[model samples]
Target: MQEIVGYPLDNFSLNLRDIVDLIYFEGPLLTLFENEYGDSYLYYWCDVDEQCNRWLVFRVTRKTLRFYVTQKLSLRELIVNPVDGFLYSIELDDELQCQRCCLIQPPNLPPKYIPAVDSYYDFSKLDPEETEAKGLLLEKIWDEKHELSDLLTKLFDKPPLEMIDEPSLA
Candidate 1:
């Protein structure tokens, strides 16, 4: 196993919570399927189009990764947040607390463990445990999100305001 003395700024650290939100599974995405019920699973594409949000609809199939990004969303913002995504949402045991599952260097490292100054990374691939962990983290974050309802309003096929009514004339 490759030790982390120093790693690149863009390295993936995964732990199994299976939190990713799959899009292909929702209804046969890309040209892969036409079924309305073919839900996207762990193995799907992350489509990135200029006219779409900078989101990833990723999947791992036969040990190969396939991803597509949206053209509509700014590519830079994707590293932080995307309408759809591939990320980790760390879960605190406390019901009200929130933490992000991250791979970045720990703030306080022991004297023995030298933080790698040189850029290094393992691009070989992610193992099963890692995949499951990231997905789980994303799922947890999705559950605890504070603005889900409002975001959904914007995502709906109908306009955000059309589905609601004016305040009752009480």
Candidate 2:
């Protein structure tokens, strides 16, 4: 358990949300630490470049920790969801020296919801517009069936879109 009180701060910059954003996207392994005062912090190492790597520490509330331990919310949820108050973050160098410290204000937007059908379909090759259209279509189909197995069975019964001839557009 690393303590934050005695940690050295140098070249500290405020509002490093970009670094936090990277951590949120990468989903690195999290280590929990507590200071003598019982403040909870999550620590994770991030490699920003070939030569640069840093440790990110986020101070989280007890309620947030409880939700995480109880499996009621995921770690990513803790990062993206707006906290009751500001979320404090510390960026430390390889030697555990603080390079930046900031309070992050999470956007007041809903967490992104990934539908189950995303796992079944490969949308990586599709353009943005096509991907959105296909995703919506798949979501609708998935909702109608309410089960992946049922959706698969139904899909197998129907002719593929490519197999069906398109009407001539004169």
Candidate 3:
């Protein structure tokens, strides 16, 4: 599997160690899908605490992943925009460290929903076993390692447009 450089955990209050623990040990990937532009969106179920369990979706661009793999960016720089959710952008200083991050609120959204945390799945009341089982099943179908590598290979190595000549007119 290709090495992963960064994760989109900047919006959260987690430190590097906590982020790694959450990703590798605690969180279970729920699903993954690619957009027409070859960008990958991954959803993960995180058991943040005894009282809080939520879902997070990350939008990782091909360029961003490339930058991450090359060590040009840190995991905190990855943008975690949940599906049909809030948007956030991060700025980095010359030292390649995060400078400032802001939530890009949509104008149509109400002020009460500025952060829009409600869009994500909150499984605080659900049974963990069932949720995790479903998550594992999803992981099996859209295996992150294989899917990501395939998408990255296509994005980086394949031609942007396929040219097929039209059949000769009779």
What would the TM-score be for candidate 1 when compared with the true structure?
0.21
Model 2: runs farther than 4 Å from truth? 1-28, 45-47, 54-56, 82-84, 108-170
lDDT of 3 by residue, 70-168 (tens): 445544344232333444333333443544334443342233322323233222322434544333323333435655445334434532233223589
Clash count, one per candidate: 35, 0, 2
Candidate 2, residues 120-157: lDDT per residue as tens digits?
22223223344344333344223333343343334355
Arranged by TM-score with the best first, the candidates are 2, 3, 1
Please give me the total number of clashing residue pairs in predicted model 1.
35
Better of 1 and 2 by lDDT: 2
> What lDDT would each prediction earn against the true structure?
0.28, 0.43, 0.38
Please give, for residues 18-100, the per-residue lDDT of candidate 1 as tens digits: 33332323432222111133222231222322332111122222111122211222222332232233322222323413232
Q: What's the true lDDT of residue 47 in model 1?
A: 32
Worst 10 residues of 1 by lDDT: 62-71
C-alpha lDDT of residue 123 in model 1 = 18
Better of 2 and 3 by TM-score: 2
